[model samples]
Target chain A: MAGDGRDERAWVRGAQAGSASDLEALFRAHWARAYRAAYLVVHDAAGAEDVAQEAFLAAVRALDRFDGRRPFGPWLHRIVVNRAIDWARARALRREVLAEAAVSAVPAPDDPPDAAAPSAGILEALASLSPEHRAVIVLRYFLEHTPGEIARMLELPRGTVNSRLRRGLDALADVVEQDGEG
Target chain B: MTDLRTELEFAPLPGEIEAQQRAWRVVEAAYREREQLPRRRRSLRPVLAFAVAAAVAAAALSPPGRSVGGWIQDRVAGEPDAEPALVRLPAPGMLLVAAERGPWIIRSDGSKRYLGDYEDASFSPQGRFVVGTAGRRVTALEPDGDPRWSLARPGPVADARWAPSPGFRVAYREGDTLRVVAGDGTGDHLLARGVAPVAPAWLPREGRTVLAYARADGTVVAVDVDSGARLLRTPRARRVREVFWTHEGLVAVRTQRELRLHDRRGRLLRAPAAAVRRELVAAVPLPGAWIMYAEYDRRTNETQLVREACFGRGPCIAIGPSRFFRGAGRLRDLTLSPDRRWVVAGWPDADQLLFLRLPSVGKVVATEDVRREFDPGGSGGGAFPRLAGWCCARASG
Candidate 1:
C-alpha cells in the first residue's frame, strides 16, 4: 500500500480537486499499512478498522483544506496512530472501572503464514507493553518516523519518546530471549 | 538482541485485507454522500435594501408583534426553577446518559466521562461494565470507558442488553437479526432472523438465560436461549415499542397505543378500560405487582404518570389517581431507581430532569439545564440527553 512520492502527490492533488478515482487511489495505497498500524496499537480487529476508518473520514473532511504540496502519508499516519492511541487509552480506563487487573492478551494475527513473518513470541511481547509504549515502537520501526516527529504527533516531550522507545525495546528483547530459552 | 525495528517491520496483522475492503467501502460511501458546505455570496446591496425595508415595516407592527410573541412564550414555557450547575445527583447510583456528542457516565457526585463515540449503550447487569454500539460494532467497555472486547457484525448494531448473572449472554439487534454473544465476546451466533428492531429483554432471574424479543411479524415471543425452546408467543400488537418481564410472571408489551400484559402462556391480560385511550410512553415494573407508566395526551399537550396493580390473574387495577408532572412538553424515558423508590424523566422542552419519589406525596425534584450539564463544551442547543439507566451503587474504592 506504499505510494511513491510522485504518484502520491498526484493522487492528493486530484483528490483535492474532487476526483473520486484519485481519492480511491490514495485510499488503496495507504489502507493496509494504516489498518495494520492501528491494529498493532489497539490489538482488536474491529477497533483497528474503526480507528482507520475514522482517520480516512477525517482526511476526506479536511481534503479541501489540506495543502496539496505536502506529503499525504505522514499526515494520514498521524491521524491513524493518534486515534489508535486514544482508543487504547479509553479501553484502559474502562478496564480500570471494571477492576480488571490485566489487559487481555492480543489475539492471533489474521495474516496468512509467510516465511518472513515475525515470530508469535515477539507479537505477544509487543502486546504486553502498555499502548503508549507500543505506539512509540510502532512509529519508530513500522512507520519509520523519527523520535522528534513522533513527539510532535503524539504531543509528548522528545525525551519521553526516547525513554519509551528504550524501555519498549528492552522489554521486547527480554521476552524474546525467554522464549528462546524455553 | 536483534534490532527491534527489524522485528516490528515484519509483524503481521490478521484480516488486514478484509478490514481494508470493509473500511474503504464505508469511507467511499461517506465521501460520496457528503454534502458540500455552502459558500458565502459576495454581494450584499440587495440584502441591505430588503433588511432596511423590513425593519421599517417591523417598527410599524411592533406593538401587536410583541403581544403575540409574549402570549406564545407564556404558553410554551413551564414554571421553571432556578437552574444550578449539576454538582451532585439527588440519589446514590450512577447515571448512564446519552447526549448528542456521545454517551456519558455520570457519577453520583455529578462527575462525568464521555464514553467515546457510541450511539446507544446499556449497563451490564451489576453495573460493572457498559456495552456500547456504533455502526457495525458492539463493544464491551469498562465503566471508565475502556474497551474490553468488540464484535463487528455485517450490519449496524443497536439495542444491546446484557443478561443478568450469571451474566453469560448479550442480546442485540443487527439489521433486523437478533444475535446473542457470550459475555466475554465469544460464541456469537444468530438467535433469530428478521426480528424487530426493539432491544431484547432478558428475564431478571439468577442463572436464567430466557429472553423476550419482538419479531418482524409483530408478535412478541419469549424463548429460553439455553434450551432453544419457545417459552411463550403472544398475539401481535399494532406497533410494538418494547417488551418487559414483570415481577408477577407476566410479560408487559407496550405498543404506541396501549400497554398489554400477557401471562407466561401468552394469554392477554387486559388493563382497566379507562386506561386504554391515552398513549403509553414508558412503563417500569414496580414492587409487588404494580406497574408505573407515563401516558401523554396530544390534544391537551399534557403527560401523566400513573401506577396500577396487575396480578396476572385479572385486569390491572388503578392504584391511585394519575399524577401530572406539569411541563410545556412531554416527559419521556421513564427509568426507576435501583431501589425502586425514584422515577426519573427527561423533559426536553424545559431542559430539566424531573425526579419523582414514589409511593408517597409524589414530591418532585427538578434539575434544570440538563443539556448543558451532560454536554459540557457543547452548543447547549442540541437534543436533550436521554436517560439510559440508573445503575446500582458503585463498588467501594
Candidate 2:
C-alpha cells in the first residue's frame, strides 16, 4: 500500500515541516496504486485521474493537521476509493437514464480504444460487477488489505465486507469462465 | 482456474505512469499554492474559548445586539451606499430562500413564511406548491407551509425541480439515482441512476416532459421522460456543474472551465471565450436567448456578472459592459428575478445580499445583516442563506 512505514512517517514529518521534496517523494510513491484502485472502481480513465488527483489534493490540504504516527496509505486510499465509488454510482445513474438506442450505441468496456489497450479479460470481468463490489475487490486483492482492515477502511461491517467479497468473487469467477469458453 | 487475487494484483492499469505524472503536477502545484492558516497556541486557548462562547451567547440573547451592530457597522462603514435591510424586493416574485432553519418563502412585499426544516427546496411552476426535502423525505407543501404529500425513499433526496407548465412531474435525485414523481405525488419511479450531483433541468416546453442532466461520465443527455426517448447527448465535458435548456431549444452546459451551448440535436452551438482564468459559479438563461453568468477570478477575489444575448441569426453579442461585484471573499448564488428584471447575489464577507438591475447597471441594492436576517432568534453565526429561486410573478392567494 505504501513504502517503508518508517520512511513514510519521516516523509510525513518532513512534509509537515514544509519540505517539498518529502511531499514529492510521498506523492510519487503512492500515486500509482491509488490511481489504479480508483480506475478499477470507476472504470473510466479520466474519472479515475480526477478522483485520484482530488484525493491527493485533499491530502495536501489536510497535511498540516495529519498525525504522523498514522500510516498515510489507508487514509489516502479511503478517500480515493470513496470518491471512486461516488463516481461510479453517478455514472451508473446517468447510464440508467440513457434511451435504449443510446444504451446500445455506447461501446462496451471490452472494446479496445487503441492497440495498446490492457488485457480485456480481468478488467472486463470486473466491469460486470457493481462499484461496491469492485471497491471491495480492489481493496482486498490489489491493495492487499484483509477483510477486517477493508471493513474498517470502508466503514462497513465486517460481515458486510465478507459477504461482498464472497459475492464479488463468485461474479468474477463466472465472467472469467465465460470469457475462457468464448 | 485463474486465481482472482493474482489476476487483480497483476491486472494491467493502462496509463498509470502517465496519469501519475499529470496528477503530480496538479498536486504539487496545489501544495505549493495552499494558504496555511496559523494554528492557535495552546497557552491562551482557554481565554479565547471563553471569549468566543460569551460572544455567541450574547448574540443569541439579543437581536440588535453586538453581532447585528457589528454587521451594520461593517456594512455602513465599508459600503455607505448599501441598503440597510431587505425592505422590499426590487421586482415582483416570491423568493425561495434556505436558511439554517429551513426553506422560507418571501413574498414581494417582504412577507416571509418558513416552510419547515427542509435541507433544500424549490417552487412549483405556478408557485402554488413548494417541494422540499428533509433527509430522505420529499414533501410537497402548499404556499402556506402545509404538506400536501410526502414520499420517503431509502436515500437522502436532493435537487428537487418541478417541470414547467402542465407541471405534472417533479424530478429529484435520491442518493445518486434520479427519480421522477407526478406533481400530485404519485407514480414515483426511477428515471435514471448514476447522475452527476448537478440538478436535472427541465426543457421549459408545454405538452412534453423532457429533462436534461449530466451523467457521471461527463456527457450531458436530454431524454423524453414520458417516452423514454433519448433526444440528444452532447459530447463529454471535463467536469460539468450545471445544465440549462435555453429559450432557443438549446442546452447550455457549464463546466468548471467553460460554458458550452448546444442545440436540441446535440450539435455544438457556441462557447464564448472566457477572459482570465475565472471559474464559472452560476448561470441562468434570460429571455430572448440571452444568458447571464457569475464568474469568479481566484487571483483577484472578484466576481463579474456578464450578460450575453444572441440576436436573430448572427453571432451572440455581449450586451453592454460586464458588471464587477467585488468583495473580500467569493460572491456566489446568482438568482434572477421572476420578471427577468434584476439579479441577486449572496456576498458573505460583506454580510449583504446584492440586488443588481439587469440588462444594464441601473439601481443596485445591498441588504446588510443577512446572517441575522435569515437565522433570526438563533446565534447569528450561521451561514448566509442561499437565494434558491425567485418564484414566478403571480402571488398565490
Candidate 3:
C-alpha cells in the first residue's frame, strides 16, 4: 500500500503537469483497486468502469490542488464514492421523470454484468447490503483502508465508520444465511 | 466464519480490474491530450457562458418542417455515437429521445412514422400516445415532417395529461393560478387556481387530479383539482423526491428508509424497514395488481426490483435480482417498460445503454448504440433519467 501510494503520488504530480505516460502509469497502478471499490459498491460493471474512470479523472484534474500529504487511495476513494453518489442521485431523478411520464408495469431488467466468472455467494450477499455499508466493507476489507482512513475519506466520525463496518458485516451475514436457506 | 474479510483481501473482481484499467487508459489519454495543449490564457467561464447561451437558443428554435415523428427518426440515426439526446426504452422496441430538440418522443419502431411527441410529454398507464403538454408550445407535424402547429400560450404551461380517451390535458402555471389545457393544446380550462401547485398527478378512471404543493411549514399538501379541496397534508418527506399516482395507489420514496404507498383516497400503505437500500431508481405500474420499483442494492452490488401492492391488498413482491449492462457496473439512468416487463439502464461513463427483461428480471433483451452529445465537465450526461415514455390513446382503427 505504501509503495502504491508513493508511486501514485509521483504519477499524480506528473499527470497534473499533463504527462500522458504518467497518467497511464497511474491508471495501470490504481485502476484495479478503484474499479473493485466501485464494482463492490455498484455491482454493475458498466457503472463500475465509469465510476473508476471518473475517480481517476477527478484525481488528475484536481491533482494540482491535491495536498499530496495524504494517501492517494483515500483521495481516490473519496472521488469514486462521490461519483457513485452522483450516479445514484441521477438514477433517482431519471426514475422520477419516468414515473411522471405515466409508464405502467415494471420495465425489463438490465443486462447482466460480465464478471470474470461469478464470484462466490459472498458477492451475491454483498449485493444485499446498503451502499453505505457496502462502502465501509469495501474500504475496510476490500481496499484494506483503516477505519480512520475511511472516516477521513467519507468525512464521517471514526465511530460512524466503525458502526457502518460492524453493521455491514452483520447484514452481510444475514444475507448469506438467508441464501443458504434454499 | 468463511471470513468475508478474506474475501475482500482477494484480488479485484476478476476481469473487472482489466476493464477498469482500459477505461482508465482512455481517461488518462484524454487528460494527457488536454495537457499538451497550449495553456489557454482564456478562462472557461466564457466557454460555459457560450454553451449555456447556445442551449438556450436551441431551446428557443423549433425543428423545421419535421413532424414530431420525423424528428425522432433523425435523432435515432445518431444513436450509434452514444447520443445523449436519444434514448430507447426497455420495451421490445421503443426509443425515447429528443427527436427535434424540444419535443421528446417515444417510438414503437425505430422509424419516425411510429413516433409521437408531447408538448408536455407525460406517459399514460400503458405508455400510449405522447401526452401533450398544456399551455406550453407543441411542435406538431404531419408524417412527412410538415409543420402543422407550433402552439404557444400567453401563460406559462404548468402541466399536461391524457385522458382515458384520446383527450389529453396540460396544466400551466400563470402566476398563482393553474390553467389546464386538453392534450391537443385546445379546450383550455382553469382546473384550479391560487394553489400555486407544483406536481399535479391525475388519478386513474376519474376526473380527479391531485395537486401537491409545498406548505409554509415545508410539508406537502395534496389537493384535489375538481374541488380545490385539500385531501391530505403530510410533512414534506424528502426535499428532492418524486411522487407517483397509479390505479393501485400513490407511492413515493418518503425517505431512504420509508417507501410510502396510499390508495386513491390517501390511505396508508405498508412501510418496510429495509436492511440495505439504494435510492429509489424508478417505479413502473403494472397491468393488474402490480407496481415494480427499481432499486440499486448497494449490498449485493446488484440492481433490484420489488413489486408491491397497487390495490392496498398485498405486500411488496420481490421480482428478484436484475441484470445490469456493465459487468460489475453501477446503475445509472434507468427506465421501465410500460408493461413493467422491461427496464433500460444507462451508464454514460462507459458510453453504454442496456435494456433488460423484468419479473423474471434477468437476461438482456436488447443492447443498442449510444452517442455522447454533450460534455459539460467529465460527462455532462452521466446516467440521469434521460430516458422517458408515456401511455396515451392511439386510434386503434
Candidate DockQ scores, in order: 0.14, 0.13, 0.13
The lowest-lDDT stretch of 10 consecutive residues in candidate 1 chain A is: A106-115
Number of the predicted model whose DockQ against the real structure is largest: 1
Alpha-carbon error at B360 in model 1, in Å? 3.4
Candidate 1 chain B lDDT trough over 10 residues, lowest sum: B43-52
| Candidate 2: segments with Cα more than 4 A from true spot | A1-182, B1-64, B67-79, B272-276, B311-315, B324-328
lDDT of each residue in A75-178, candidate 2, tens digit only: 88877886676556544533443433477477643233423446578887888898889999999888878899988766567998999999998998898889
Per-prediction share of native contacts kept: 0.32, 0.35, 0.34
Chain B in candidate 2 has what TM-score?
A: 0.79
- The model with the greatest TM-score is 1
Ranking by DockQ: 1, 2, 3
Q: Candidate 1's residue-wise lDDT over A80-170, tens digit each? A: 7866765665555444433444433432232213233344777778888887789888888888899999987765689989999999989
TM-score for all predictions? 0.57, 0.56, 0.42
DockQ-based CAPRI category assigned to the predicted complex of candidate 1: incorrect
Query: Which candidate, 2 or 3, would have the higher TM-score against the true structure?
Result: 2
Q: After superposition, which runs of candidate 1 have C-alpha atoms over 4 Å from their true positions?
A: A1-182, B1-79, B271-277, B393-397
| Model 3 Cα lDDT, one tens digit per residue, B1-397 | 3377666656346456456546654564446544543432211101011011111122112221012222223222111212112222334434444321223333442222212323234444334344443344543343212344445766655444444333355444554555665555566666545543344445555454555543334344566654678777554454424444555545343434456665544555655665455655555566566666556556654445455544674555544333222222244435556455666665332334555555544554322223222111122323232454433233111
Best lDDT goes to which candidate? 2
